[model samples]
Target: MPAGEVQTDSIVRDALNCGKQVFIPYIYGASKKGTTNTNIKSMMEMVKLNSLADYESLQRDRWGIPAIDPNTFDQREHVLQTSLEKGEGLDIIFVPGVAFQIDPNSKLVKRLGHGKGYYDSFLHRYQTKFHSTGQQTSQLKVPPLYGLSLKEQYLSTDDEMEVPLETHDYLLQGLAIGDGTFHNSTS
Candidate 1:
């Protein structure tokens, strides 16, 4: 954990100190095949990690996010399968976003991700009622999904601006800003 950042540093530090098992997303370019698919598609995988040494062992990906090196800790298939079948997976997910469009009236928030669609893809399957098909995503029953954003990333809610939505994007249930305030969706 470093100083003068989004304070998730403290969250990690405290979680570790409290003897919590901290797992970071270990992304791999998984090649998928469909019945009539032409291209090999890539997806992200969640990998469970424990211990300080585990954190130190990771290397940054192309996007500069520190991810677990698959050579040391690879638990892709296990994590995904277990998570889909069991509810005892990650207690909370902190997502990073490029911009946020919040509508308190509708109790919804749309996140525009940083292009790779890693979080977007991951959250669609992970979050409780939210799916990739853009159905009912705001029931908030799953482990809390919080979006981490800088204050500048938050768009004005007063204007009712249209945040463009693609079918692959997922909705967030809560938001945590760099300023240290956390906002939960109101139902």
Candidate 2:
């Protein structure tokens, strides 16, 4: 789903209820290709800040208080690390992007995010952490990562572009549509 229509409140509530620490990648501007900064601020408020005023104060004055930036590797790493620490490890990540697809073989989902490769970098780091801890096999039980999308943007099998195999493997999930439609390669 477009970040604007993701129903962040609902997703956050669900994750919190399930004892999942939610890490949402917030986008910066009109790119409209990832979770917008506004949405991220809103989510922080809903989950940690407790109020708009609290969020504003933190953003306005907090030095080194991680902010989202798709192009900077250092910034991305810092944000991921900070979120992981706050949540005790990212159990669920709400990614934002323009398009996504499911790969039947790898059972992975691919999201067409912005040009920066922030998502890819974050995923790589996360997987590395999982692997280094020798929990890769056990952690693999996490279901296919679901790519949120809007109804009108759904692509059919006949779509011209083939999602790269590497991208598919990175996600190893499925796609979720805004109108309650869920598509999976296995399905």
Candidate 3:
């Protein structure tokens, strides 16, 4: 992983070692109908990683992040599929971002991504698909989003810097700082 990005190999190892189900983002170009949509050229879904060995065997992308092979896309189990069939969604998501900040007034976490909108889109899709199936929100839970970032990625709260966010942006529930500190937003 690059210095700019938080290393997640240890997280993956720990989760796997604990016998937790682990999923990784798989980005591709497809529409809601499951057809190639080269026009927009971006859609993301979390695909299950069977084991730490599976993660270790994956190839890294240009950003030096491990990416699943396209040939195995059809064979892998999607997080959405599990949510839909088993009625169990993720417990938490460790979000990655270019920058993050806490809104002073609202006490909510805000994340700035790499401009791809992949994470936002996937979360929105998950909420819509999983929760809209005529089930109680309690029965079908939406996972709390927690950002993972280095200390440098957090904007200076001392200086009162504001993070510019749009309506479509999803606010994070908490933050896991690389320096071994955690920040949870009251909102």
Candidate 4:
């Protein structure tokens, strides 16, 4: 809420205006040790924005990211965990990246993060856990990871950002970059 320049528009406002649930990242642990956890679904609480003031009323942490109060959301529903339940799973995730390298054939966007592997860790574990139970039944839809960046940060097939990737690193290629969305990464 400080300045929308980094993100441009209030995606939260638009989503909430349409009666959609908005989940911001609930980050924990220490990033200095390379172990930051973002429970974007379970830990993250949905905001019920009655107006623009509701969005403005949200608080920000030291990192300047908007946060929601857990006490405000309903305790009965676990949106992230329930993604794999009822024959539906995480449909879409707006993965943040400093830059991206798209695989030629797969077109999946590998995130060049801010030297921290938090998203990679969470995505890897989420996919593995979701697959363990949902794979056999053909009921789970692993959320397609996407990213948006300024056109200046866009990397062509030739450019390499040299972001190191580990075995646990998730290669998320599907992205709804800017105004484009496609189905190729997850099913």
lDDT values, one for every candidate: 0.63, 0.49, 0.83, 0.55
- lDDT (Cα, tens digit) per residue for candidate 3, span 1-187: 4779789989899999999989999987676436555666768899999888998899999889999998898788898776556766787888899888987767778899988889998899888877676544675577889999898888856756667799899999888888887888853
Lowest lDDT sum, 10 consecutive residues, model 3, at 131-140
RMSD of 3: 2.2
TM-score for all predictions?
0.73, 0.55, 0.90, 0.65
- Tens-place lDDT per residue, model 2, 11-70, is 655655666544444433433334555533221211232233322333311323333333
Q: Which residue pairs come into collision in candidate 1?
A: none
Residue 139, candidate 3: alpha-carbon lDDT: 52
Off by over 4 Å in 2: 1-5, 17-19, 26-90, 103-107, 137-143, 161-169, 185-187
* Deviation from native of the Cα of residue 85 in model 3, angstroms: 2.5
Of candidates 2 and 1, the better by TM-score: 1
Candidate with better TM-score, 1 vs 3 = 3
Off by over 4 Å in 4: 1-9, 30-55, 70-88, 135-139, 160-163, 176-187
Itemize residue pairs with steric clashes in candidate 3: none
RMSD of each: 5.3, 9.4, 2.2, 6.0
Give me the candidate number with maximum TM-score: 3
Quote the lDDT for 91 in model 2.
45
Report RMSD for candidate 1. 5.3
